[model samples]
Target: MSSTQEFIDEAAKIYKVLSNSTRLKILYYLRHQDSETDVKTMVNDLGLVQPIISKQLGILYRYQLVCRHKEGTRVYYVLDDPHVIEMIDDMLKHVKHEIKGEPHPRTLYDNKK
Candidate 1:
């Protein structure tokens, strides 16, 4: 495949990963954390079952969107890229404006004032 197609494919994969609400919740939860978080903590805090959390975490790890480390018998996860967080934050702001029926401020894609 050409380099342009490869880049589009990778970008599509990332969007697919982010398309799930469960995964987005996981990312948002991790964003507020002060340190690496374990599965059990996520289960209790997010009100999700252990199996579901584990499954979603596996996908996040596979995408390299989150990093993990072993602590004793537990595995802890933290965000691997601040750029992903920024992208999510920007999208969220846009969403909020849409929901409020307010005009979104100029963004890179906007050429008109």
Candidate 2:
């Protein structure tokens, strides 16, 4: 396969992982926060068990979609980059404001002239 094909295939794998709402929600929640939080927080907020979150995070880490840090016996996961957070945040903002309700105007006008 060509370089482009390889890239697309890799992207598809990440998308396949993200296609599940559980994983996507995990990513979304992790996207904003810089510091690593424990799985208990995920369970408390996302209602996912520690094992399940660990499994999904493993998949994300395998695909280079997330990074995990080991702190003694506990492992913490965070988005691989700030860009990932920015992209997800922008996407959520777009969907929430543009598609979920009446479409908000795309541009603002000034009457200073």
User: What range of 10 consecutive residues in model 2 has the weakest lDDT sum?
Assistant: 104-113
Most TM-score-accurate candidate: 1
With a 3 Å backbone cut-off (N, CA, C), the pairs that clash in candidate 1 are none
Per lDDT, the best of the predicted structures is 1
Give residue 33's lDDT in candidate 2 (0 to 100).
Answer: 68
**Candidate 2 wrongly placed segments (more than 4 Å):** 85-113
Give per-residue lDDT, candidate 1, residue 52: 99
Prediction-by-prediction clash tally: 0, 0
Candidate 1, 1-113: lDDT as tens digits = 89999999999999999999999999999999999999999999999999999999999999999999998999999998878989988899989998999997777778753
Residue 36 Cα positional deviation in candidate 2, in Å, after optimal superposition: 1.3
lDDT string, candidate 2, 9-100, tens digits: 97777668767777778888887666887777777878878898888888878877788888788788877756655766676788888667
